[model samples]
Target: MHFDLVDLRLFIQIAESPSMTQGARKAFMSPAAASARIKNLEESLASRLLYRDSRGVELTPAGQLFLQHARVIMRQVDYMKNEFTEYGAEASGHIRIFANTTAATEFLPEILAGFLAQRPGVTVDLQERLSRDIVRGVMDGSTDIGIIAGPIKADGLQVIHFSTDQLIVITPLEHPLAQRKKIKLTETLSYPHIGLHEGTTLLRFLNEQVALSGQTLNMRIQVYSFEAMCRMVEAGVGLAIIPESSARRHQQTMGLKIIELDEPWRVRERSILVRDLEALPAVIRALISIFLTHDSARERRS
Candidate 1:
């Protein structure tokens, strides 16, 4: 029937206080204005809502029924206001994020833990995929944010350089190459390698490096996951190139030896991807800030 929110608010105040003067005071309006609002609301509903006599104003049968609906609408409006208010402060709502396997398993855990500690009301749903898939997810509206190793070419996504990760060459502790201080590209290819599948960014980067050094990587196994690569290296199956963070994450249990790749292929930048900078919700922005500032500080300390 198109009753105004102002009239609904006045009706609620009058219903609660049962006194038009008190309702007017609570609403910061004159008694005449409050009565007129109540009158308009009753007219909109085509019913007589209140009857005033010796004992404060009393609701008619229709007024009592409509009051129930009015209370529900008021509560819903209040909840909406609170939700938006908390959203602005990064204190509420859900965030959908996509990350590569390395970031999902190795890096994002601690960062997400810290973010949740600060903003418990905000929930994050993270999905792990290949770096290329992560970029596609961000572009296709499947995810609110993404983290991946760069050379990202997605035109629709906004990329931010968040942190740098070094790829380390790993081998079984007993492997003869484990003792090396720095492994050259040529030396690396001399050993059979356990590597990621063909389409992954890591594999692409390694292939580029191998081509640049005028050698072909003697890839022995093509696995889909880094954890699998680590297990294979631990079993002395073959050596693999993986991020230093992933190496450290499994260091103790895997008992694998890790060596820094020599000059040419040392570090890779981990970039944050967003669909639109302006469209990012406050909680996601706060999380990005947390990752940037906290990871930078942790990197400096190390």
Candidate 2:
């Protein structure tokens, strides 16, 4: 009825390896000891967890179920250890943030630099995720905060206005589309496009929109960064959809024309979402405060 972490860890290792000997070696235990520990674990559970043969070992159905729970337990243990390890230091805690494409790429770098500079003890784990996924991560306690763009329904979470990010198309100055002031996404799909590389949050979102429009994007080239994509577009390669901030900055130097997107969804209001604002640690609250202060300053100027 009672099982220890060591027994569970060893069982997981054994299940992953081709043989108990290899698993024992990885676990830093002798094969005999490993075998005995596993035997005791199976006896306690009253189930045959593995099948042994001359070649290797295979997990039984019960073992498969046990392995899933064991992995989850170990992961939570590690996460807990990491979360509290710095609490003994001065004003420190780990914060996990999930942000969408625009927030992660265009907004957070400068803000995070200042935040981290002031508090050396605090650490942030920031990850880029789709907005819907970021919302789920915040609600499920996987992420402490979420920054998302567009109007995604967050029924119960606390929401704060972060910034406004608008998507616009950029084309070479002499291109046919450059003559126009505005256009729809569907209209641009017929033309060759320069896009961000696969797996970017922005590209994924755009692809989803393309699918919903019942059309496919004709991507001529895919690059890693907005700067690169702009360069490609300026070379008459293809048109590109980029953030308005980036398009404005690049337009000053690059020979590109900014064309407004006529669709209503093109202008996205980015927001910060959190499960609870009052319950957050001081460090996270400070970070959120910085976000709001900067956003407010920008709004006032605009």
For all candidates in order, the CA lDDT equals 0.80, 0.84
Candidate 1, residues 65-171, lDDT tens digits: the string is 78767765664454355358744547876777888767776668888897888876777898877777787767655567889875678896788998888888999
Question: What TM-score would you give candidate 2 relative to the actual structure?
Answer: 0.72
Listed in order, each prediction's TM-score against the native is: 0.60, 0.72
Superposed by TM-score, candidate 2 places the C-alpha of residue 247 at a distance from the truth, in angstroms, of: 1.3
Best by lDDT: 2
The lDDT of model 2 is: 0.84
Clashes of each: 0, 0
lDDT for each residue of candidate 2 in 32-53, tens digit (9 for 90 to 100) = 9999998998999999999989
Each candidate: RMSD: 16.4, 5.3
**Candidate 2, position 235, lDDT:** 93
